[model samples]
Target: MANIPVIAIVDDDEAVRTSLASLVRSIGYEASTYESGIDFLNRQSEDPSCMIVDVQMPVMTGDELQARLVEAGRRFPIIFMTAFPTDAVRQRVLAAGAHCCLSKPTGGDEIIRCLEEAMAGHAAQ
Candidate 1:
């Protein structure tokens, strides 16, 4: 995690991206928003402390993004969020070494909790 603790929120939905960014900022962390996985992959210059990425997106999914990061040797604690969550999805992401998996319509506190857990080197359930 970065000393300043930036939390990157990546999702295809404009509303979701905005809301999570705002909520994360309110809690005293630098929040960056991206509308897609490719956007974050191409645009992010500085590494964030944690990532809140949507599971389902147009071009690339959160799991795929994680895989890319791993291959590139850039590891950030990742929290995967999904509107349509399933046990298989959850298990797969966890197996792939994601920090946490969250359901959409999630509250700010839950996100904070996940972030906290991740930063502490613990995978949140």
Candidate 2:
């Protein structure tokens, strides 16, 4: 893979997707924005270096996407962001090997940190 990583931002809200993609791009990653998990699933080419997805979406939730990927025997680091944060959600995603669960209005530094952490872990393996 090339050193410059691809970071996918999946969210149903247009503004959220746009802002996050812009932030990712500003951080120097090749960014792709998707309106839903299913859209990403259908269109994703090579697996992204890191995935930033919203916890709640219209058709497909981020957790559902994670499950589907796992069912397909695929492993990748996911960073889930949500306006509503819960202990249960945190536990589940963490147990499933997600990179982090961040609350919305999350800082750009934090997002970048999580992406770097996710890629670092992947690289170690």
Candidate 3:
């Protein structure tokens, strides 16, 4: 909620998570990486921030995680990413109130933009 936004990045791919964390940190935000959605849920940090999750994780998919978050009454904005992007998947994530559903090759600028948008929505509340 301050100047340095905290972003939770959940993905099964170690390389993807590492790269994302590095990129996110380079942009001056705090990034926490989790190997799986269940891992993140276990930590349960009450940090008010946004999330970047992979759609094809091993245990729980990004969409499934979003549903669980909703069931638990958690409203942090999410940006779902997938290598195999599809209209149906995008629509599903969007309908779950995600800020965006982006392809895996999304750049830092796009991620930053989504983060800013998500922060703005939180600010409004």
- Each model's Cα RMSD: 3.0, 1.3, 1.7
Q: After superposition, how far is residue 51 of candidate 1 from its true place, in Å?
A: 0.3
Model 2, 3-122: lDDT tens digits are 888888899999999999898888788898999988998999678888999998887899999999888877778999999999999999888878899999888899888889889999
- Among the numbered candidates, top TM-score falls to 2
* lDDT ranking from best candidate downward: 2, 3, 1
User: Candidate 2 versus the native: TM-score?
Assistant: 0.94
- In the range 1-125, model 1's lDDT, one tens digit per residue, is 45678888999999888888888888888998898888998999677878999999988988898888888888778899999999999999999889889898787788889888898783232
In the predicted model 2, the residue pairs found to clash are: none
Candidates in descending TM-score order = 2, 3, 1
For model 3, how does the per-residue alpha-carbon lDDT over 6-113 read when each residue is reduced to its tens digit? 889999999999999998889788999899989999996575488999999786898999999999999888989999999999999999899888897988899889
Local error of candidate 1 at 22, Å?
Answer: 0.7
Which residue pairs show backbone clashes in model 3?
Answer: none
In candidate 3, where is summed lDDT lowest over 10 consecutive residues?
Answer: 41-50
Error of 3 at 79 (Å): 0.6
Q: How much lDDT does each candidate structure score?
A: 0.87, 0.89, 0.89
User: Which candidate, 1 or 2, would have the higher lDDT against the true structure?
Assistant: 2
